[model samples]
Target: MTALTERTEVRPSSPSARSPLGFAGLIVLLVLTTLFVIGLAVSFGSVRIPVGDVWAIVVNRMLPGVFDVWWSQARESIVVGSRLPRALTAATVGAALALSGAVAQLVTRNPLADPYLLGVSSGAGFGVVIVTVLGFGAGMLGVFTVPVAAFVGAMVPLFLSLAIGGRYPQPTAIILVGVALAQVFSALITFSLLVLADERQLGSVMHWLAGGFGDARWSTMIFPVSALATVGTAMLWSARRIDVLQTGDDGAAALGMNVPRFRIVHLLGVSLLAGAAVSVAGGIGFIGLLVPHLAGYVVGIRAARLLPVAALLGAVAMVGADTAARSISSSLEVPVGVVTALVGAPLFVWMLQRRYRRAER
Candidate 1:
């Protein structure tokens, strides 16, 4: 047995060959895919522009000297001023949530986990309700109040869950505690909406809860993009530790890793990603839960490879969902969250069934 183990170790498969691409290739592909998807998403809406026109608009704006003759004020306004920012925001938020979910699942070692499973979304919703329903949007103070309230709301449940679940020991117990806190916060949100908000105010509150890209202004995109870049960089840097942790806590510790410290750092990063996403997107669901799992199944369970692939899949999913939400009805645009749920529910079930079948086999 000792000789066999030594032989296996000596002939161990190269990690580079296993992934079929270096880190540079992965990054370049991710960037190209992101740009392509963003362009596709921007060109599509209630009023569809031809693919040629889409590229024309993008090239004319991005490379004026190269495509100066293709410039048009009307097209640029429609694409650049309106659709481009919204599409980019959607991609960034989707990628952030998916990556956060991936990291959260790794840190918690819970198959059923998601970034916002710890009551983060509920907290953000509660914050938005307090600001919008209380008639605070018109004031100068209200400018930063919504996001501030959301940040506080997100952190509250995270710390509360940690406190209730005890120290960094049992992942299952921690997950259960998070679920309980989520339920409590969700109930609070419902009660506030029902008791404090009037009928007129309730309409706006419901709209926000349903989630849409309609609010994806330049100002709103700043925070989400900034948060995504920062948290994503941290996650990427810690990817190898995540892979080690997947081998079990004892295995990770035996390999000279500080398991507890790694978990804390990953948890904090995911929380920041989740909070910022919830603040901007207003509780878009299923992306975090579904995207990471899908990426794992498609690529592999290794967190390092799964991270960028999950981000791409998430961007594609959200951009497609948002397009459907806008184009589904001529008279009204459906909420992007509703569209995601409609599509994601069946896909999620299919994935679970496949996993079960594989396990049985």
Candidate 2:
């Protein structure tokens, strides 16, 4: 645990480093791009709304009596009632997952690591299945049951990993423990879905496991958005610590960091973000794996520079994927997770191959 002898830091390209002004410009571009993607997502549903009208509808809703009643009630309903919440939820969940992923990779020093590398997704799925199949939390928490169950379930893996890792927890120990727990939780979810879940519950369970913002509402956005704001701010505040930790345990110790304690706190934060995202979006994958790597490529891997870009890039990717999921077929909505997996798998391979090439050089 004291030695980082096995770990190798992933260096960023020199040319990718950002000046403050250039970084600000990049942030602006990504923010605008995310907004554009959200607008597209709002416009692409069953009844297509133009982008201009989408913004207009949003403005009217926010500042009532300001704009005339030009747009139809039905159009407003579609935008406000359905797509707006869904799109915003997608963005929030994306940002949460991406930020969680960044922190996970940073703490673990594993390039391929993701938010769910700690088993949070599996735990969340198991929780959802337990509630949906067994009706365990039906009356206890009301509409809040699933999310609360999910948050609790997600904590299971964290506690287990910590217990198994003992006092001086190392990145490798956490990864191995997480993988084991993830598999166990995944198996439980499968058994529950297959044996306990009835025909009626199957559709929703499958949709949720595959991940989509189909059920997203203004009400559902509360937890994830709040978690992202809190956890994201904490991560930004600890940017210097992240930079130190990235230099490995030896370097972190020299900088007076309590490496194990720092890792533990980071894991807890990751679980919260991951749980919030999973509770709302239901096991959305690949954003965590893909976005940080993409963000690193653009911003040169400093946590300070990398985090915001990763978040915005994630939002853009998620909204774009959600839009595609909605627009793919007139008859059915595709799972946004499925879309992300389809894109993420190949892109990840390319990333791996690119890394190998760089290593060879």
Candidates' lDDT values, in order? 0.75, 0.83
Model number with the top TM-score: 2
Model 2: which residue pairs collide? none
Q: Could you give me the TM-score of model 1 versus the true structure?
A: 0.87
lDDT of 1 by residue, 1-361 (tens): 0000110111112345134565557657767877777777777866667667887777766777665555467766888789988888898889988998888766766656678866778877777777777655534444456666666677787778667765757544445666677777788879988999889878877887787787777777877789888889878888888888877778889999987767766776787788888777778888988998887755566777788888887887787788788889988989999998898889989998997798799
Q: State, as a TM-score between 0 and 1, how close model 2 is to the true structure.
A: 0.93
Clashes of each: 0, 0
lDDT, candidate 2, equals 0.83
Scored by lDDT, the top model is 2
Q: Candidate 2: where are CA atoms >4 Å away?
A: 1-6, 12-21, 139-142
Q: How would you encode candidate 2's per-residue C-alpha lDDT over 55-93 as one tens digit per residue?
A: 999988889887777789999999999899999999999
TM-score of each: 0.87, 0.93
